[model samples]
Target: MDTSASSSQVAAAAVAVAMALLVPILSAAAGGDGWEDAHATFYGDETGGETMQGACGYGDLFQQGYGLETTALSVALFNEGWSCGGCYELLCHDSTYCAPGGATVRVTATNLCPANYSKPNENWCNPPLRHFDLSKPMFLRLVTDFRAGIIPVTYRRVPCAKRGGIRFEMKGNQWWVGVLVFNVAGAGDVKAMAVKGSQDGQWADMSRNWGQIWNGDKRHVGQGLSFRVVASDGRALVLDDVVPPAWAFGQSFEASGQF
Candidate 1:
């Protein structure tokens, strides 16, 4: 009755299913552990090839929604006249995620709350809650009122770019800030990312992260960049340990010669 061949086929199918489940777990074990470095440029959309360069470690000032043409995010050691070679590479960016909604806005976060709720968890749709619902096409800057927890009052000057969202303004130079996203449920690949800057971005920091949405830490205490995740399940997304690392970079000239 060809029983042996049929049994072999069933075994093979079982093996395939096992392999599929094992792949994600194995990849997470190998890649999403500890602190890793990521590049400043990544695709902010689902096109898979559309790349967007990150702003300097300080912040990005966009004229509109579209992306910069060829301006790669500049990077160097935290020193005057520093170049890319032999630099410490402060932050490593994870290009794995751009926007939760797969939009053209690059990096985006969720609101993490129901419409009836008075306040949102965080602007990025990340809260300490176990479950959340996500609005599609999340943007990177859609942060929550986390200033009370992680940010100090001295650095609490929100940027105009923030508009109605959460954004920070760090006045000093040569400091680096970072943003990261993690898989809280440990279902998908988690990642941590950092962005470095020195002397107001004469030198630059990159981004970094883990495999899943877990806890994160940064050297800079001032306000940091933002990232987001979809809302679901009982697991929560936490952003913490945002610290500014000391750094220095070359000087710059103003058009008005104010200096």
Candidate 2:
């Protein structure tokens, strides 16, 4: 009956299934506790005027719009804007450079540093894999002296406690639909999203278009929108019928809970 070979095969299959389940759990744990020492530097003027738009597709820097007033991160930390909207708590460790109270500030990931794209010879934010190119205002807030060109800092990802609930911005028209998610709380950056139409039971995958914006080109205007969002830390939430049947273009919808 070849019982020994059959048992071995079954055992190997069990091990493979266990490993597959363990990978996601390990990844989530790593994402939650991943902290690193980094160097920080300031850019732009003290007033934050004349600041350029970031690679995350956010246009305004310090305005009333969403993602405004958020701090920009280095391109190294941006991870091609995948870290956009992710929140971090940073503290300056350099005694000489840090403020007297050792101030800690929470900042949202908004932009990417151009220096990361430069060649090794010309790279400004060089060597350090973890770096932060803070806005001039944010940088000054952490340092004792405004003249400190660089400061040693410790940073870790933290939950984003936005005032309101998670908001969804609607774009496109009756034929095509695009949705931009904002104000995510726990694990701010979305790893993936799926949308289900009220009439259809199937879930349609949404593609990422820089930062927190996700899009799906399905003619889903008439039906209500339900979203299943997966966070970077592997937390998933299904917000049933978040977008009501009477949704309009450019309108924002808020969900009660977050991932």
Candidate 3:
């Protein structure tokens, strides 16, 4: 890891923070067109060790393709874990620490910043307040001072831009089929996933097992499988024959559908 910051790096960061403060950014949660108020702080060091495995079940963040571009959503925004993979755009609104050049960061909501019941009054993640626990790199990209532990910010939900198609990691067996869905673009959160076997007469709803994984009862062995993915926007995309009849547990399947 590079332990030293070059002069150019510092100057660039200062400019970005300054611009972030001056920009009048308007954004959305997919419905509204205006940026909302929020507070932000940073966690973990340059290694990002503490930021890796999180509450969202997005195990191995970098291995899953989300590098330092991630944040932990406070209680107000986590939506009880359903907002796990949602994306947001944020910038420092106004702060003494802010330095020119609007610097906005698009980050995936990878974890939950749980409310501290013991210190509700002091906890930024307490209910009714919108906050973000950003990774150190992302925070430094906006503010130069690590001492500026917290800063006022404006944020809005944005579509996640993923490179590949949706990937489903198969888990469990035929009797209790569980699949972990990831790499989703657009409205990244999955409201529900309906699975149908080639031999089945109708689609079977899969309940949230944990995080992004969904499970369903019944066996679909030796049957070509189809999936109906319903994203947070309430839109559904049916991937025909997403899995082969010989599909087995522990295998990942990728389908060319974006939502």
Candidate 4:
């Protein structure tokens, strides 16, 4: 028997099993309901730009952009954008930096804080897992002083609240149909989407292009669009006949229900 090769295979299998075990623990740490202790710092204006966009395909939340509030999470909190669009309520606990009453603010996860993005000492996600790099305006809302650079915070995930109902943006034409979902409420991020054409009477799975967009090549024009959205938490919502038969490019349709 090749003892060395057998040992190598066993080592590889052990590593794989270890990785599988770590996944659930990490996921729970990132997405669990329990409030977690974390650190917070602010970005934008003081750092440089007023306008910014995130890897999750969202524009700036501070000034004029997509009109959504923005919050950048540490690499740990970002979870590779799996936490995109998710809302979080953060409460400041540092008596020196934060007010005595412990002010709280709710913000949406819009971006990732990579290691190279900031100074080595300021890299929040490196060793410590839970961290938030909030927008300057957001951070100020929870603290009494702007001079204090970072503060201790307790944060928990919350359902997103959108002003309008869920909006569907059409990108493709008759032959190929591409739709971008927006203003998702509960669970925020989309895991999967299925589209049904009025004529076909069958559900067709749409491929995730990235972020909130999904596409499938099928003649769907002149056919009313029905959508089934699966949120990141696996909760599914079906909006029957959400898109009208005369749907046009660049037009957005609102669904009666949000996910």
Query: Against the hidden true structure, what lDDT does model 1 obtain?
Result: 0.25
The lowest-lDDT stretch of 10 consecutive residues in candidate 2 is 60-69
- Which model scores highest in lDDT? 3
lDDT of 1 by residue, 22-108 (tens): 764344334443322222222233321223222222222132122222112111211111110011111112233322221222222
Which residue ranges in model 4 land beyond 4 Å of their true spot? 1-33, 45-52, 59-68, 117-121, 126-128, 172-177
Q: How should the candidates be ordered by lDDT, best one leading? A: 3, 4, 2, 1
Clashing pairs in 4: none
The lDDT for every candidate, in the order shown, is: 0.25, 0.74, 0.83, 0.75
Among all windows of ten consecutive residues in candidate 1, which has the lowest summed lDDT? 151-160
Superposed Cα deviation of residue 230, candidate 2 (Å): 1.1
Q: Is candidate 1 or candidate 3 better by TM-score?
A: 3
- In terms of TM-score, the best-performing candidate is 3
Error of 1 at 214 (Å): 36
* Per-residue accuracy of model 3 over 1-259 as CA lDDT, tens digit each: 4536677788899999977764444332222356888899989997778898788777678867788999999998998889988999887867878534657899999988889989978999999999999999899877768789999888888899987788777778646777888888888899999888898857988889777888855477678788899999888899888888887887778898877
Superposed by TM-score, candidate 4 places the C-alpha of residue 46 at a distance from the truth, in angstroms, of 10
**Estimated TM-score for each candidate:** 0.20, 0.74, 0.82, 0.72
**Deviation from native of the Cα of residue 32 in model 4, angstroms:** 12
Candidate achieving higher lDDT, 2 or 3: 3
At residue 259, give the lDDT of candidate 2. Answer: 61
Model 1 compared with the native: what TM-score?
0.20
* Candidate 4 residue-wise lDDT, 124-172, digit = tens: 7664468888878778887888778888877888888876577787876
